[model samples]
Target: MTKERIEKILKAGANVVLTTKGIDDMALKYFVEAGAIAVRRVRKEDMRHIAKATGATMVSTFADMEGEETYDSSFLGH
Candidate 1:
């Protein structure tokens, strides 16, 4: 993903990111610069448990966000 895309996610109020995939170096830097934490390679079952505990939704694509000019903060975990 590009810096702009990363910015979009940050702007959506997600300060912590948990993913089952690896994050690129540049993206990690962007997240750190924004004071966010990105945890990669998390187990799928763990991710589901985290979401369940925090009330966050897991998204695999940016398609839902693409049509909108702004991201929905509801996707974030508390």
Candidate 2:
């Protein structure tokens, strides 16, 4: 992801991020700088399991975060 995208996620209060895609080195660095954990290349099934276990909603993009049906920082798991 781009630096600005990562910044918005952090600013929205996510401390742990899980994704089924690769995370760029710069984005990883940004996560470290913010004291957050970013785990990439996770399997989709595993992601589903995590979400079910944590009561966290999965969203694909920053734009998807817009509305009640979508997710905000409050939808994130601890």
Candidate 3:
């Protein structure tokens, strides 16, 4: 929920962020500021379809999410 983290995520050149929950105001602002689209509340089936179509990696964990001291670049969907 940190801007710096969100900024880092967008900086990885993601086309969009597909989530299982609706996006909130803070996240929307961050995505807009970083020039990325945020697609929220996507169904798992659709997420799979999009992943197959785009060849983007899906991250199941924030253990490696952006901007944490333990952040790992591989968590990014690019």
Task: State which candidate has the highest lDDT.
Answer: 1
lDDT on C-alpha atoms for all candidate structures:
0.87, 0.83, 0.70
State the lDDT at 75 in candidate 1.
86
Tell me how far the alpha carbon of residue 19 in candidate 1 is from the true structure, in angstroms, after superposition: 0.9
Error of 1 at 1 (Å): 2.4
Query: CA lDDT of 20 in candidate 3?
Result: 77
Candidate 1 structure quality by residue, lDDT tens digits, 1-78? 678778888989999988899999999999999999999999999999999999999887776545744556888878
Q: Model 3: per-residue lDDT, tens digit, 2-63?
A: 67657666666664788777778898888887778888889988988887787666766555
Model 1's TM-score against the true structure: 0.88
Backbone clashes counted, model 3: 0
Candidate 2 residue-wise lDDT, 1-78, digit = tens: 878778778878888899999998988999999999999999999999999998887877666534433235876875
